[model samples]
Every structure is written in C-alpha cells, then in structure tokens.
Target chain A: MSGAFISFQDATKDYGSVRVVENLNLDIARGEFVSLLGPSGSGKTTLLMMLAGFESVSGGTITLDGKVINDLPTYKRDMGVVFQNYALFPHMTVARNVAFPLEMRGEAKAVTAAKVKKALDMVQLGQLADRLPGQLSGGQQQRVALARALVFEPRVVLMDEPLGALDKQLREQMQLDIRELHHRLGLTVIFVTHDQDEALTMSDRIAIFNHGKIQQCAAPREVYDHPANRFVAEFIGETNLLDCKVSENAGETFSVTLDDGSVVAAHGLPGLVAGDRALLSLRPERIEILPAETDATATGQNRLAGEILDTIYQGDHLRVVIETAVGQIIARTDRKAQEWPVRARVMLTFRAADGWVIAP
Target chain B: MMAMSLFKSVYATLIVGFLVAPLLVVLPLAFTSGAFLTYPIPSYSFRWFSELVENTVWSRAILNSLLIAGSTTVVATLLGTLAALGLRARNLVLSSQIRTLFLLPMVVPAVVLGVGMQALFVRFGINSTYLSVIVAHSVIAIPFVVISVSGALGGIDRRVERAAESLGARPHKVFFLVTLPLAMPGVASGAALAFATSLDEVVLTLFVAGPNQRTLARQMFSTLRENISPAIASAAFVIIVGTILVALLLLLMRRRSA
Candidate 1:
C-alpha cells in the first residue's frame, strides 16, 4: 500500500436504487498490473469504467498519483484505455490510431511519429501501420488498440477485457505479450476480466470481487493460497466445502466433526465455538488419494472413506468424484497414476492445515 | 417454360416502361426541331438547347437555382445533423417534440407551406427575396437530412465514442473524430436529396422568390404560361437528368465507402 499509484477511497457507484460498486477501497502500487476479477453483473467493469472516467463517480473519489482526478474529464486525466471490442477508429490507419492521443495533446508531428513507431514495434505490428482496423484480424486489431493506449506514455492504462474477443490460443499469447510490455514500460495497469486463469497468469495482484464488493485484494499467490472469505475461496479455484460442526476449540486451532462422524483438525479460524457449524474449504488438488487396501491404520490428522463415483480424464490430470458418507467430493490426481475404476472404494487423506473453515 | 419466362419478361418490361415513360417523353422533346412542344415525329436538333443557353433570363434563373440549392444543402445538413445528435443523446421530451415539429414542413401540403411562408415573410419584411427562398428551401430539406443522418447514427456503435472518450478524447472530439466520419455516407446522401428537392421546388419559389431571384423551375413555370417553347422542355430535361445523376453519384459514394 506504500506509494500507491491509483487509490479508490471508499468508492461507491449507484445507478438509481441499485449500487453497482459499493465502498471499494484499495491501493494499486506503481507499475503493478492488477486485475479486477469477477463474474458478469459483479460491477468489476463498472469500477474500471469509473476509473477510466467513462462513468461518473456517484460517491467517493478516485485519486491517481496523490491527485484527486474524479472531477477531471477523461482526456485531462491523461489515462490510456483499451476497450473490450478493441475500438480502433475504422477510418484511421494503424499509425494514426496510435498517434491519436499524441495529436490530441498537441505533440510535435515528429515526436508523435517516433512514439507511434515505437509503440507499434512493441506490439510487433510495425509493418501493419498503414492498414485500417477492419483490414486486420481480431488479434491484430487488439494489439493495435494496445499500441494506441501505450503510444502516449500515459501514467496508467485501463483495459476492459481487452482479450475477450480473441480465440483461446491468441488470447493466451496476447496475455503474455501484454504482461511483458507492462514490465518493459513499467506502467500501472488495471485489467478487468471474468477469466480467472487469465488473471492468475498476468496479474501481479488480483482483486476478487463479488456483489459489488472486493472480497480480497492481494498478491496473486496470496489470494490463491489464503483467500479472505467463502466467496474468495470458492471463486479463486476449485474447492470442496464439507459441512461440519466444531467439536473442539483450543486457542487458534479447532477440531471439526464432519457429517459422517469423522473429526478433522484445522487452524486459523476465528470466533469458533464448540457448537458452531461451518464449511471446511479443501482444494481438490490438495487431497491425496490412496488405494482402497492401503494401510488405514497409519496416523493421519484428516481422512475420508469414499466410493469412486466417476473418473474424468482431463489430459494431464484425472478428476475423480468420490461419494463419501458426508457428500460428494472431487479429487484431482495426476493421470499417470494407476486408474481407479468407478464404484471402487478409496481413501482420501490430507494434512489438517490444508483445509480452512469458513463460516456459513 | 420459355414461353412463361418470355411472358414474365414482357410484364417486367411493361412495368419499367410505365415508370420511365414520362421522363423518356421529356428528354427527346428537349431536342425537338419543332417550335412547339410535340414529341411523335421531329428531327433531332440542338436548337432548343442553344436557345436555353442563350437566353439571359433562363440562364440567370438556372444559376440562381444552383446558388439557392447549394446554400440550402449546407445549412439544412448542418442543422439536421446537430438535431440528430441532440436527439440521439438527449432524448428529452422537448427535443423530441421539436423534432416532430421540424418534420411538419415535410408532411404539410406544399401550397399551405407556401402561403404560410409568404405571409410570415411579408410580416417580417423580407418577402420575395433570396433569403426568403433559401429559408423556405431549407425548411423542406432539413427533415430529409435529419431522418437519414439519424438512421446512420442509430446504426453506429456508441461504444466507439465511449472508447474514444476513455482514450483521452473529449466529448466534442469524439463526435468530430469518430461519429461524424462514420456517418458521412448518410449525411452526403441526405445533402444530395436536399439539393434535388430545392432545385425542383416551384410552388415555394414562386411565392417567396423575388424577380431577381427567379429559379429555373419558376422560370419554366412562367415560360409555360406565356409560351409553349421547346426551350422550356429542354430546361426540364436538363433538371431531371441532373437530379438523377446527383442521386446516382450519392448512391455510388455510399457503395464505395461501404
């Protein structure tokens, strides 16, 4: 949070009676590529639009570089923005589109040309400078949009699902290219997307949003490893939540009794009492599956007995659905392991610290 | 099957002949060697065309009509485009009402508009002058431009303008840079239609234009009253062809741009 480049201080946006973004407060550091990741109707795009000055700030101020820019016009605020549709001017050539901001700012023609060339070269589109937007492919047009946003050397860039229009392979390639460009230019970027993998791959920090609220904002690894709430835990990745009752509470660690009368120990839960009911979030990949005849007498903090209901081969991994006494749980295992047929009995084991209990 | 297609072809040709007969009659009559307006049997000659060019009154009238039509096109196109932009964004109750009011000139009977315009011009002390004619022409032209440009604006993606604004262009810049260029074809077609409408206007011109501001249509009407000259037929032929050519050019421009 030190020396933050863009700060949303208690920002709230309202449309009539519905509040789209409510009480959002976060500090995005300089040169940090952060993503506002959420589903449709989650107000993540609304928040990004407000920062880009397309939407009015119904309440609270958005400050950039210690200056309150909420009242400033979009152009005066000096920020670059790439839209979801890659809104390149159809009438302008690639070079002209990239030079638009410089022209608006009254830069010298020579300076504009040089900067435009550099930006297009950065996106590896220098040879296509004279082509119109309609003449280029979707991926190429998106790169032109990125180049246009970067040509003026704006302090911050806002991208609204910039890669949403591309195919899977091209989207992945552009993700890396954009990330590399961000690193080379050292510009603050606020990327908005609904794709979790894209956010995980490109963002330095990720803000998980739900119901117009930021559930957690931290380093990508931190958010993935230690999600702040139930929404964050389930949203960041695949998780298996087991309904359980708190059987014992000792200091920071607690023992929970599952529906099938099995007890599991976990740590780092707050406000847990002996009778409290909670959901234990266990990542599917974190669970270790063993053969049915494997030694059950071995010491283990958490274990479950189940029958394999289904096995799905997902290229390098196998997704096995086990119907335990508590409920159905999914475990991801390497495909190279011995295959377990359907209806086969199995034992699932994991360390106690692997599961975190979230309140109902 | 060949007989059926031949019948269909004959029917289609008859329909086209029905549409084009009046224009066909006028074109050849313009080149008639006879002094009177008759079309069946006449030697082809440039006598009428030469007379149309030589007559100062007729040539001046044609020039005046061109000036009026050109100015009216410019004024109506600008105002109509502005009105369309306002209507698209504002959609305010008053603006909508005003738009409907502006369209009244198109729907109202030409005689009624002419009489009303004449009275209004007299009261304002500018009757039968070039300004009065230009105003009357613009009143008819604005609605065409408005409807055409508005259709184009509606087809455009508003996201492009928003994208431009977010990428550091102001509202005005977005309109000029993105909205206007995208809508150019529609605006051009609208202007062409306005020019043709003004050029062919007779009732309004007769009521509002002064002696010095006589338009080609008004002159043709006067010539018809005094004498049935082949020169008037020649002028009619030129006006009809010119309007068609302008319309075709507008269509071609739209196609090329597309």
Candidate 2:
C-alpha cells in the first residue's frame, strides 16, 4: 500500500434531525483495498457515498491525493463506482455502456474502442459486449458494470456491495475476480459490505464501524486474532465471552480466576488489581478435547474442563457442545477424531495464549 | 370462484360501455346522410366528411389547433422534464412546493383559470390572440408533463446517475445523455397528453381565443350553437380517433422500450 492518497478529516453527515454519519476520520493509502464492514444502519455505506462524492461532507474536508474535494461535484472527482444493483445503462449495449466514461471524457474513437475491449476482456465478458443489459444474466450485467467502471482507469474505485445481488456462488467468484483485478491494476478500492467473510476474503485492511464510528481498523487477520475491543471481537467472528476476576498481576500478563475456580493467564493491560472484573474471549476451534481418564491433570498449560453434552457431525468438523461448571461452551474438532457420543465425560482445554482478557 | 369472476367481468363491461356510449353515438352520426344530428340514420354518405375538408373556416380552425397543440407539447415536455430533474432529490422542499403550485392549472376548474388568464392577458393587451391561447394551453399541459416525467424519474435508480457522474459526465451532460434518455418514455407520454389537452380544449379557448384563433373544439362549439351539422360530429370523431392513436402510440413506445 502506498502513502495516504485519500483522507477524510472529521467528516460528518446529518439528514435533518438524524445524523447518519458523525465525525469520521480515515486515511486510505493508494492501491489499498479497504472494506468498511458493519451491520445495517452502521453508516458504512453512507461513509462510502461521501467518499464517492454522491453525498456531501457536512462538516469536514475530504482530500483526494492531498487536495480538498469537498466542493467538487461527483463527476469532476474522476472516480469509478460500482453499485449493488450493477446500475448498467439499460438503453445501451454492453460495449456502449463500457464506452460511456471514455465518451464523457471525449476520448478518441479508436482509443475508446481498444480500452472498452480490454476492460471487457478483463472481466471475461468479451462475447456479451453487443447484448443489452436486460438481455444478459445478472452476473453478466454486473461484469458489464465492472467493465464500465474500469475502462476509464480511474485512480480510485468505490463499490457499495457490488456482489450483493448475486447468489452465494457467483458472489464468491466475483469477490476473487475483483480482488485479482485490484491486485493487477493497483487501483485503490473502498468496498462497503456487511458480510464479515467477504471483507476478510477481499480486503487488505478492514474497518469495522458501529454507531457511525470505526471500532477498529487493521489487517483482516489482525482484526480477527487481536481485536482492539469487545465490539471488534464479537463483530468479526463468534467467540465465547467468559467473566473472570483478576487473581494476580504480572508485568504484562494477568492471572484471572474463572467462575469455576480455575486460574488462567491472559496477556493484556497494565495496572490491574486482584479483584478487578474482566471479560475473556475464547475461540471455539482453539479449545481441544481430551479423553475422560487422560486429562484430569492439567496438561502443559491447559486449565478448563467440561463434559460433552452433544456432538454435531459437520462434514469437515465436529461441533462439540459441552456443559462445564462455569457455563455451556462449544468446541470444534476435526471429523477424523474418534466419535464422541452424547453425555461423554470429556476434558476441554485451550492454551492461555488463545484467550485474551478484554475490558468490559 | 368462476361464477363470481364472471359476474364481476359483466359489471366491469357495463361500466366501460356506459363511459364509451357518448363517443359511440357521435362516431356514426358523422356519416348520416340527413342534415339533422339524430341517431338511427336513414342513410350513410361521405357528405359531412367532405364538408369538413372543404369549409375554409373550419379547416383554418383545425390548422390553428394543430399548430398550437404541437407548440404546447414541445414547450411543456422540455419544461416539465427540467422540473422533474430539478425536483427529484429528497431535499428541495421549496422546489417541490413550487412544483405542486404548477399542478394548480390541472386541479382548478378551467373556468377559473380562464377568467384569471383573461384578466392578465387583458392587462397585457394580448387577450384573445393566438399567443394568449398557446400560453393558456401550455399552462394546462405542463402539469401532465411534469407528472409523467416525474414518474419516469422515480422509476429510475438514482445510483445510475451517480455512476454516470463518477464516470466523468458533467451535470448538464449527465442530464442530457443519461437521465433524459432513460426518462424519454415519460416525456413522450406527457407530450401526448399535452397535445391532446390543447387539441380538445373548448371552454378556455372559447373564453380566450380570438375569432381567427378559434380551435377545432371552439369551431365545433359555435357550429352546434348555430345549426346542428354532421360536420361537427365528423370533427368530434376525428379528434377522438386522433387522441386514441396518440395514446396508443405512447403505450406502444413504452412496451417496446420495456
């Protein structure tokens, strides 16, 4: 990723009495694929629209390549946009749709033709160029829209759930295709989506927003493995939140006592007393299950224990639901393991490094 | 279920027939050989149709009506489409209110508008002229154009316009190349309505038109007052058929575009 090519300085948008987005600040590097990930009404799409110049910045400046673009009209910004519905020009053929931006810029006829052909070839929709948008399938129309956006070779591209209208299979395929296109072109992309998996799969960096503010922004794995806060952890993926009280304070690690009178070591925070309440996030797949007679004693650095209440046989893994002394917990195991039946006595254990103490 | 649907279908047919009965009565009467405008014709002939084409006064009125209606259609469509574009956004309360005010000519009784325009045109000393009639017709027709074009604009996904803008189209270029082309069907329908309104207009034209500026409807009105001529029925039939053809053309255009 290059240095900051687009910056939002305290951007705000208010729709009369309701504030859709409030005081948002972000710096997007050139050639970086950033996904604004959030649930509905989280203002992710609103922020994207503001960057695309569709919506105005009510109280802040949006600088593109270090120049203020707050007063520039959307057309003058020289950006490309792909909409969720694909927004292909219904009146024009696919080739014509792809040629529209070049036509707008008054490009030479021969150059526009070559660029349109190259764009269509990039999306693998070259044969459908003569068809009207209505005559093609949904996925084909989306490719035409993509081709139209890319033909101009704009520096930045904004996508608002571009694959939202496709089915699961096509959506996944398009995600990989778009990601590859971004890698090849080295064009900056700001994608908006509510799907965590999609964001994790495509983005170089993910910004998780809530209540019109970014809760955390980092690499995809960083966000998933080392979330900055409780909201970020819960929003990224499933986690078992357990309540604990601090029992010992080391230099950087804290010894916390779980509800079941078990002591576990977690790495976070300073200035924590022995009696301070904290929340621990435990990943399901990180927990390992041992045979009943084998692990009454703590093995290596494992502490938790539970009896298997049920086992769900997924094709690739087994989901084991356990009833522990503290609470009900879930553990994911490989399907190759010996089948654990209902009501089997089991010892569930996980590394202290896998669980982190999050401030409540 | 079938019996109930049959009864509903019959009821709807009766209502449609009742609405169309007046127009049906005038259509065949245009071909009646007798001088009187009675139904149950004694014989049929083309005498009234020939009279309609030969009469200089009625022909001139028809020509004037066509010219005025054509001009009204062009003016109303351009202004109405522009208004639709200007007022399509969720904001712009004042512009929307002003748009509602433009619809006043459609909702208000034509007599009231005619009286008001008569006063205004008199003050300007242009009352009862072709200019006065064309202006009045435009006022009446603009609301229809506005309504149709607005409907078309509403049906379009506004994101497409934004996409066009992001693709480097200036505001005016976006409107002309992208927005106007998408909304052309609505503009066409609106223009059709405007032309029909101006062509068939009688009450306002009677109040505002000079003798030389009399439209086909006004000419038909005067002919009825003097002596009931089959030529009046011929003119009515022509106007009705012309309106239907224009309306059908609009529907066909919509379907083809779809």
Clash number for each model? 0, 0
lDDT of each: 0.88, 0.88
Q: Judged by DockQ cut-offs, is candidate 2 incorrect, acceptable, medium or high?
A: high
The alpha-carbon RMSD values of the candidates against the true structure, listed in the order shown, are 2.7, 2.1
lDDT of 1 by residue, B1-258 (tens): 999999999999999999999878777888889999875737889998888788898889889999999999999999888888788874377877877987888999889999999999999999988899999999999999999998898878877787677667888899899999999988998899789889989998888888999999999999899987888889998898888899889889887776
Looking at model 2, the pairs that clash are none
Best by TM-score: 2
Where does candidate 2 stray beyond 4 Å? A248-253, A269-275, A296-298, B94-96
Cα RMSD over interface residues, candidate 1: 1.4
User: For residue A320, what is the lDDT in candidate 2?
Assistant: 86
